[model samples]
Target: MFPASKQAIGMDLPAGMTLLLTLGVSGLILYLSIRTSWIWRHLPPGPTPLPLLGNIMEIGRSDVANSLKKFSDKYGEVFTIYLGSRPVVVVTGYKQVKEVYLDKADDFLGRGDLPAWNNFYKSQGVIFTDVLEWWRELRGFSISSLRDLGFGKSGTEDGIQEEAHCLVEELKKTKESFIDPQLCLRKAVCNINLSTMFGNRHEYEDKDLVVVLSCIQNTFAAANSSWVQEKANPNSVFTRSHLLSSALQIFFAGVETTSTTLYYSLLILLKYPDICAKFQKEIDHVIGPNRCSTIKDKSSMPYTEALIHEIHRFIDLLPLGVPRKTVREVTLKGYKIPQGINILPLLSSVLKDPTCFKYPAEFNPENFLNEKGEFQKNGAYMPFAAGKRNCLGEPMARMMLFLFLTTIFQNFDLKSSVPFEELDITPLVSGFGNLPRNYKCAFITR
Candidate 1:
C-alpha cells in the first residue's frame, strides 16, 4: 500500500471537495423528500413522525393490528394517515369503506402500483392497473379465457372433476393418516389454475412450480412489512419493471387467498361435526352418493352454500383490506383529500362488525340463512371485495368452491391434527396479504 501520510496529503483538495459535494447532495435529497409528501401537510391525524424514518420507529412488528385498532377507536373509521413520504387515508368502518368501494368506486377503484409493482410486472395486466377502461378489457380476457377452460356452469366442472380425481388420488398415495391441508389444498386449487391458465394440471411433484408458488406466498406474506412498498418502487427487490410484481400479484391473489378460504370451509365443518353431518345428509339426499359434485348441485344444497358464505364472512384474509388510491382530489365528510392518497378499506372491520353480522365472532351459518333456512346473499358480506373493482373471478370462484368442497365431503372427511379451534387462522402479515399461520389437517377416509 502507498504511504498513508503521502497519499492523504497528495489527495487532500480532491477528497475535501468530494466530501463537500456529498454533504450538499444529501442535504438536497432530504429537503426534497420532506417537502414532497410528508404527513404534516396532507396526511390526517394519527401519529407523529420522526425525520427521515417517519412514524416507522413507533411501530413494532406484532403491534400493527393493535396499533390500527387503536387508531380506529380514536379516528372514527375513515382518517388520513401516512407511510413514509406517502399520504394514506385509512377507512375503517364498513359504511365509510362501502362508500369508497361501492358508492364512489369510480374515483377510488384503483390502487397505486408502487414503482416496484410496475417495474416487476410492467403492470399492463388487469389487477395492477387502476384505470377502469383497462381493467374491463383485461378482465374480459381473463373471464373468457377461464370460460373456455370450463370455468362457468359445468364447462369448468370437467376441469374440476379431473383435478379432484387427482387430488383424491394424491391424498390416497400419501396415506400418512395426517397431512397439512395447506399443501393438499394448494395442489387442488393450483391445479385448477394450471389446467386453465398454464395449460396443464400442475403436478404435486413439480418442485420448481412449488418453489415459484412458495415465492408467491412469501411475497404476499410480506404485506405487513415495508418491503411491499419498497418492492413496489421501481427496480428494487425483484425487478426494475412491473412485470414480476404484476405476475406475483395475480398468482398470490388467485391462489393463497382463495386456497385459505377453502381450507377454512373444511376446518369449520369438522369442528361442528353435527353441522357437517347435516350437510352431508343434505348432499346425500340431493347430489347423492354416486354422482360427482357440480355447480348444478349448488342450488339444491342450501346448507352447504350458507356455510361457504359464513366462511367468507368470518375468515377474512385481508385484515388491512385491499389498499386503493384516489384517481384525483376528492372531499368526503368535509375532509379535502387529494389524489394518490393510499386507501385502506377496513374490510375486516366491516366483516367482523357486530352490526353487520349478529354474534360476529362466533361461526354461525344462520347469519347467511333466512327464517326459512334458504341461502341468502348478504350484500354486506363481501370477502372478495366490492364495487367496480370487485374480484373479477367472482363467478368462476363461486362455481369452483361449490364443486371442489362438495367433492371433498363426498369423498373424505377433512380433519385437523388438533381441533379446528386449536388451528390458528389468525393471519400472518406478508407484503400486502394476510395468510393462515398454520393449516395442518388430515383427510379421513370415508
Candidate 2:
C-alpha cells in the first residue's frame, strides 16, 4: 500500500481535471459574450441576447409579428434582433419602412437566405433568389407574359368570371347545409393560376391537381421534402429547377393569399350582416343580378371598393413581409446595418399605424373612406409590400379579389352556421402568413 499523502495526491488529480474543464467552459462563454457585444455595438440598438440562441427564446414560437412589435416599442422604430447567430434588423412604422423599402430600394433589394425557402427551392425562383440579373429577366418576363395573357388587363376578366361562376355553382350544391368553404375557395383560386399558367383547370377532385395543391400547401406548412423535380436544360438561364421553382412560387403566392383574403372577406360579412347588406345593396345597384360583376363596375361601387381595401389593410397578410438583405453596408435611419444583414420591414405596423387611420384595430371601411364618404387611398397601405421587390402578383390578386368577392356576394346571401359572436376571425397560424381559422357558412340564393 502507498503512503497516505501519496494516495491523497492521486485522488486530487481527477478533481484538478474537473476544475480545468469548468474553467475552459467559463472562459469560452466570457469570450463569446465579449465578441457578441463588439459586433452588436456597431449595429442598431436591440434587446440583449443570450449566446448561440440569440433572441429566439424572446421571440417565442407564436405571433412573431406581435412579439417584434413589442420589441419595437422598447427598441424604437429601427432596431436589431438576432435569429440564432444571425442578426435581423426590423424597420417599423410607415415613414421608416417607406424610407427603407421605397427611397433606398436598391440598397435593400437582396433577398435574405431563409432556411425554409432555401431548403425547398434553393433560391431558384424570383421570390427568394438573390441573382439580380435573373430577377430582372424573370420579373420582366412574368409581367409581360401575364399582361399578354390578360392577368391585370381586360383579357383575363373572362377567365375570372368563369371561375367565379364555377365557385357559385359549387356553393349551390351545399344547398342550405353548413359547409367549410376553404377547400372550394382554394380550388377556385388554384384553378385560376392553373388556367393562366398551363391553359388548363383541374376539377376539384382531380388527383394530380390534389397532389400539386398538397405540395404547395406543404410548402407553407414547412414540409422540407423535395416537392417539384428539376426539368430545365443545363445551358439555359432559366434552368429546369428555375422553371419548376418559379411555377411553385407563383402557385403558392398566387393561391394562398387570394383565397385566404376571400375567405376572410366572407367571414367578415357573415359576422356583420349590416355591412353585408350595404355591400349587397351596392352590388345590386351597380352590377345587378342579370350578369356577372366586372372590374369596370368597381368605380361605381364605393362601398364595395372601400370594403376590399379595408380587408387588405385589416387582414395584414404577410405581416413581417419577406425578409430582405442589404446588398452592401448601408446606414439607414442613423443605424449602421452591415452588409448581408436580414431586414424585416414590419408591414403590419404600417397597415395598423394609428396616425394613418381613424380606427386601426377595428375593421372599419371608414378607414379607407374620405369625409365625403367616397373611397379613398392611404399612403400607408402596403399589403403587397413596397419597392422594387413588391409582390409580382399584386395586379392579378387585386383583380381576383374584386371579381371573386363581388361575384360570390352578388349571387348568394352569406350566413354563418354558428353565432357571429362565437365565430373566431383570428388566424389559426401567424408565422410567415396570417391564415384564418376554418369556419362553416350557408349560401342561400337571393
Candidate 3:
C-alpha cells in the first residue's frame, strides 16, 4: 500500500532501537564500574573483601580484639576497612587515638546504632539512646546517685569486705580445682554489683540472677566493639539501633569489664609471688596487721595504690575500648571526617605508650608513683577513658577494685596454676573488652 522506500523505512524501529541502545550502553558501564572493585582503590588498604559477604567472610568467627590487632599490624594506625557495606576506620597508637578521644571529644560523643540491635534488643535501654544532651544529663544523675550510695569512700568498702569473705568461703568449698573459676568470680562480683545497684543481695545460686547475668553476657558477645564499630552514629542513639547498643553496652561495659579486670589483677598478682609479697607487706606496714585494706588506707599504702593502678594499666582491658562517633563534622589530623565516621580510642594503647610509661611491656607500679611516693596522675593512664564521657561507674569501679583486692589478700595467699608468662593474659576473642582466658589458682588460707 506504500511506496517501496517508505515501506523499507517503516521496518527501522527508531524509538525502540534508540531506547534499547541507551540501556545497553548504561548496563555495560555499570557492570564495568562494579567489577572494577573500588573499595580497594578508594578505601584504606588492608583486608580485601570478597563479593557480597565482605571481610566478615574471610575472618570467620574470630573475636573482635584479635582480628583488629591483626589488621592493626598490617595496616597503619588509622586504616579503613569495610564490613558488609559499612565503613570502619581503625585508629591504633596513642597519638592518633588521643586526638579523636580528647582533641575532638565534642565531635566524637555519639554511640553507634546498628540494624541487628533494633531487631533484637527491644531498644529502650539507656545507653543506646541517640540524644547526647539527655544522655549526659542522665549519666550525670546516675553517677551522682551511685556516689551517694557509697562508691569511693569507706561506705562501699564495708560491702566489699562482706563480698570478699563470701568469695574466700566459696573457694574453700572447692578444695581441688575442679570448678570453673569463672563461675566463682562471676557469682561473687555479680552479687556485689546487684547489691550496689539495687540494694539487694540475691543469693549466689539465685536462678533469676544467673539468667539476667547470662542474658547480659550473651548480649555482650554479640554486641560489643563490633556493635559500636557498626553503629558509629551519634544521632542513631535516639533510634532503636543505638538503644539496643546502649542498653547492652552498660551491663557488659560495667559488670564484665570491671569483673574481668579484677580477675586478671588477681591472676597477675597470684603469678608474681614476689610482687604479691611486696604488696602485702606494704599493706601491712601501711594499715597495721589484720585490718583489711580500706579506702582510708589508700594514701598510706602508696605502693598498694600504685599496684592497683598498674594492674589496670598493664592488663589494658578493652583493647579497642568503646568506639566514639563524631557528633559534629570536625577536622582531625588534617582530615575532615564527616559526622558518624567510626573513631576508636585505644585506651590500652595510651596506657602503654612508650613515651608515657617507663616499661611499656613490663608490669611496673613505679610508673604510677613519683619521687615523693604520691600517686601521680597521668593522662595516659585512662582505664575509665577521659573527658566529659569518662566512665560513669569509675568511682564505684575503683572502690570495688581496691576493696575486693585488699579483702582477698587480707584473708588468703593467692597463687596461680601457671607461671606469670604461662598464665593466659590473652583475652577471650569476644570484643573490645579482653575477657581473661579460663585459668585457675589456689586460695591458700593465710
Candidate 4:
C-alpha cells in the first residue's frame, strides 16, 4: 500500500481536491480549538465561548446590559465576556468597578477596544486613543482651552442662559402646539458646544450652523477653522490629526450625553406630574420666574439637585461607559489580567448598585435626598464614571443639565398628550445610550 501522503497525491483530481479541503478545514478547527482554550485558560472564568463567535450569540444584540448582568450573577462581578475573538473582562457592581477605576487606575489607564471607533479613530484623539501620555497632554490642553473659552465658569453660565433664552423663544414659536423636542434639544446643546469651540454663537437657522448640524463634513470644517489657527511647537503633541480628532470628540461628546440626559429628564418628569410639580416648585422658589437660573443657585436648591442626580442615576445613560484596558499586567480580585486586555466597568452596575441607592430599580429622587430633604451625594453615583479617565466635561455637563432644565421648567410647564400612565420612561434604545422613547409635548408658558 502507498503511504498516506503518496496515496492522497495519487488520487484522481476530484478526490485529491476534496482530501486537501478536508485536511485544511480540520487543521483550522484544531488551531482555533487550541487558541480558544489557551485564551480562556489565563483569563478570569466566563461563559464558554464558541470558536470565532466568542460569546457573541450569548450576548445577543439588544439588552446587552441585562445579558451582562446575568453573567455577573452566574460568574460573579469580575468575569470575562468575548466580543468575537476578543475577551473583554466585564467588571460590574460598585466593589469591582471601584477597584478597577480607583484602586488599579494606573494599571488600567489605557482605553479599551471599541471596534466601531477604533476602525475610524485608530488611536487618535483624547476619547478613543490608547496613549496615556497623549491623552494626558490633550486632556490638559482641552481643559485649559475650554477654561479660556469660558467652560464651567460664570461666562459659560451666561452663554448657556442666553442659549436657554433662545430655546425658550423657539419653543414659544410652537405656540403650545405639540412638538417633538429631540431636534430642538440637540440643536440647543450643539450650539453651546459650538460657542465653546468657536467663541461665538450662531442663529438657530444660520446656514453654516444648520449645515454643521446635518452634515459631519461641515462640522469638521467648522472645527478646522478654529483649531488650525493655534500656534504650534516643533514637538507639540497637538498634531493636525490629533486636533481634528479632539475637535470631533469634543463636539460629539459634549452634545450627545448632556442633551440625551436633558431629554430623558423631561420624559421622566412628564411621566410623573407630581415629581414635575415639586421640581418646578423648587425652581420657582429659588430661581424665580423673572430671572434665569445660575450655577450659584444650585447649592440652595437641594430638591432640584436631588432630582437632577436622580435623573442621571435612573436613566443610567452610557451603561457600560467607554471601555478601558490594562496598560500592564495586573491582578484584579486575584485574577491575572494581561496587558492590553479590554475592560468594561459597568457604570449601570454602580449607578444602580443596591447598597448605594435606596431605590436602585426605581425613579425616586429620594435616592439622592436625605431625611431632611437635603441633596446628599452617593459614592455610587458615577454617571460621569470615575478614575483618571472620568469625563473631562463633567463640570460643564452638570452646569448645562442644571441651567437648561431649570430654565425650561421655570419658563414653561411641560405637557404631553400621552397620559401619565402611558408615558414610557424605559430606554427606547439601550445598547450604547439609554435613550427615551420619542413623543410630542407642548411647552406652555408658565
Candidate 1 lDDT by residue in tens digits, 1-446:
85679777867678789899889989987786667545336455666544456566554555354466677788767665556655567777667878888888887866664666567545556677665565665566555645665656564678888887777788877574776677777767876765565566667888755765666545334431432344554633322222334444556566776777777677667677787887888888887776887776778888888888887777776666667888877776557677777787777778777777766788788888888999987767877789877776777677777777777778777676787656655556533455546655667777
lDDT of 3 by residue, 1-446 (tens): 85669756766778789799889988876665476355234444567654445577655354665566678778766666566656566676777777766776778788655456445554345554455775775566456656776666565677888887787777777774534566667777777766765576666667876776878645444433333432545644344344344545655566787788888887777667788998888766776556666788888888888898899888877666766667777765555556676666666667777888888788888898899878887768788877767776777788778877877777667667766668766555656466667777877766
Tens digit of per-residue lDDT, candidate 4, span 304-352: 8999999989999998888999999999888989999999999999998
- Residue-wise C-alpha lDDT for candidate 2, range 198-256, written one tens digit per residue: 57788777886666677764433343234233334454546655655665787788988
Clash number for candidate 4: 0
Q: Clashes in each model (backbone N, CA, C under 3 Å)?
A: 31, 1, 12, 0
Question: Model 4: runs farther than 4 Å from truth?
Answer: 1-20, 225-236
Measured on C-alpha atoms, candidate 1 has an lDDT of 0.68
Candidates arranged by lDDT, highest first: 4, 2, 3, 1
Which residue runs of candidate 3 sit more than 4 Å off their true CA positions?
1-75, 114-119, 148-150, 175-180, 205-209, 215-252, 371-374, 418-421
Model 3 lDDT, residue 137, Cα: 50
Best by lDDT: 4
Given candidate 1, what's the lDDT at residue 405?
78
